[model samples]
Target chain A: MDYHWDWLFFFRETDDGLKYYDWILSGLGWTTLVSLASLALALALGSALGVMRTTPKRWLVAIGDAYVDVFRNIPLIVQLFMWFFVVPELVPDRLGMWMKQDLPYVVIAVVGLGLYTAARIAEQVKAGINSLSRGQRNAGLALGLTEWQTYRHVRLPMAYRIVLPAMTSEAMNIFKNSAVTYAVGILELYFQYKQIIEKTSQVLEITIVVTLAYFALAFLMNRLLAFIERRTRVPGLIVGGKGSN
Target chain B: MSDFDFSVILENWGFLAQGLRYTVQVTITAMLGGILIGTVLALMRLSSLPPLQWFAAGYVNIFRSVPLVQVILAFYLILPMVLQMITGKQMPIGAANSAYFTFTVFEAAYYSEIMRSGIQSVPRGQVAAGYAMGFTYGQTMRLVVLPQAFRNMLPVLLTQTIILFQDVSLVYAIGATDFFGAADKITQRDLRPVEMYTTVAVVYFVICFTLSRLVKLLQSRIAIIR
Candidate 1:
């Protein structure tokens, strides 16, 4: 063996019989919480902005474009640092103190991750909406529905279905992105992994475990979304447009 | 708020440029390495041989599913130790080299997928016709398919490059002074995290936004209008 491998490192007790595995599980909890919270925020804001981007009005589309452009371009770490250090300072004194001192780092991670992923999600949603035939939108309006109602009743459902494949990938992307929350001091999986490495010199063992954990997370998300995508896929919509005939 | 000064940007331009150079260096080097490796991987996945196909599939799945930071970290911290053990000597790889190598391998997975699709986008007829003209499979792909596939995937390749640039920021995890790392150092030094960090964000936004615009323009211009 080129290296000594400790197969039971996760089972090793740190204090009072509490194994290192406990810390990892708790970190997983935080990672899941931040990712789920960010997913919710990204979806809500992304759909709104996505709808705005596809609307007939120029300014609303412009607002949507600007939001995606600004947020998507900035690195998530830089954005998190801004949310952590800059946003608090720009706010009121008490709020600043609260964010600086009291507000949990996980919450800040959620905000940063959510807003950042929202930009990418918005683009996916817009593409989905554009993929739908114009007749769908026209039909809804022709049936005496208002534009919002047409979008809500006709466009969004189909758009969501159309983009579900892309959206699934984005969901996995955000889960992976949540790993960066370590920079903000959230003791997520990566943070726990780092702490473990600091205490134990079993670098390869710990990295393999953590990397597998993330791979499993992403794989499950991809599979689940793919399942949903298959179940919800409209028949005959797969042929797509402008075939090079 | 008024006391927040942007003067630090100019003062630290030299320092920041050094970091920026590393960022650009890694990106360009990794992109070229990735494209070459990824083209091979793409061919593997598309091959009739079961082992090559399976190996390529497994490679893509493993790399794509894991976060890039962890990959970077593994190469940075673990690879050197492994190297030392294998060589029976202390071999301390620089953080920049580790990052560059990791990114090259990591980005290849992504590039493989893009190239796979780009290859698929080229009609079967082209490959068939090449073979019909007495070309070997490699010759067909090299002569007929790849040139068209490259044109087809140009936009996606550039988009991935833009993404590669953003991800270079993560090199800071291993203490490599990429662009974000340099700014981080200034923020720590000047005790002005907000100003320094915001300025860094602005630079990223402007550069990325402008490049994305260029990407869009080029995408439209080269769109294979059938």
Candidate 2:
């Protein structure tokens, strides 16, 4: 068979005649949903771990360090699998049964990607906090503030601001990384891209369209985050938005 | 842990060994190839010429934004078709080759960013000093700037290397029998997804965690105060 271009392949249904383009729109919907949900999880968990790492308690620091190490070094795809296949089996009887039967790929993707990305965010958050003057921590303690209060009242707000630019990159990365959720049978954009190609056999055109779509999403996401970062940036910290890849 | 058995992994050492070999081979080759392409892109990005800068930036942006799996799939699925049309011949690229090419090209975007930041980390006065000493731009960059820059960013580069190693597992998606792929085959065969996945995760953690600690030590050793 000879190669042929089919620009209108997305409009074509599967042999069963399911609406094709709607599949793509739904996939895009899931991708956005998974990314935003995962971002929320990551920011909350990561900031906690970051604060823990800098605390005076030795065990807390170790636990935070171990969490970062365990999550950061593992492949995200593997984590997705663990959450999907293994995690369900480990839960108690009724819940495990329900999970195996009804758990959504988007939920698993959110948890998996959130935990994995949280490690990197923790490091960024820690860096942002460490860059602050030690005097701030001292001031908080001198004011009779507990460690939690110090972190909440004095450290985390400023740290989040300092880390905003780097965090923007992480936010953009999560959206791109959400593509891997397709591995666990999530019908996200990549899965739909592969599905359309498998059905129509127009590999080149479909792949180009998908690639450009991803580029557009990433570009827009970057612009939005950069604007927020610019607004939240401190008066004279030299950490300009030199983006990482 | 109760259901886990070491004998399964022990009996499958040969399979894992083969997978490990491919992993090392792919990682090293891609690291070298990525560094080469990335250095060029970084230089182009930092160049005085506007077109060169824009071209480099655009290339990095596109590649970085696309997920690695999509890029890998595109190469595996799309490139051969384009090659056939251009050459009028059916040239089949195998999974391993496609994985290699994809990782190299995809990773160059990340490495380019690292290299650009590394190069920028060098003090500007060094280049000026090189010029004052009658050195050409190339001589200044090669002799004075890069040495210090590499030292300054060695930890960051090594950190990225760890990240690259973690990402190599994505090769499994294309059925390249790397470390994760081998585990996956056994996992499917034995229906021991948890055990196999745990083993794979532990192996990755050990290798990457140790290397990161070494990088941290090296970072402290070679830190540039300025």
DockQ each: 0.71, 0.60
Best candidate according to TM-score: 1
The digit string of per-residue lDDT tens for model 1 on B47-87 reads 99999999999999899987787788878888787788788
Compared with the true structure, the alpha-carbon lDDT of candidate 2 equals 0.84
Q: How close is candidate 2 to the true structure, as a TM-score?
A: 0.93
- Which residue segments of model 2 deviate by more than 4 Å? A1-3, A16-19, A91-95, A230-245, B85-87, B224-226
Candidate 2 residue-wise lDDT, B1-226, digit = tens: 4667788888887998788788888888888999889988998999999999999999998888888888888889877877888898998999988888888888889889988988998878889999999999899888998777777777887788888888888887688999888988988898888777888888988999999999988988877456
TM-score to native of every candidate shown: 0.95, 0.93
Distance (Å) between predicted and true CA of B9, model 1? 2.2
Span of ten consecutive residues with least summed lDDT in model 2 chain B = B1-10
- With candidate 2 superimposed using the best TM-score fit, by how many Å does residue B106's alpha carbon deviate from the native? 1.2
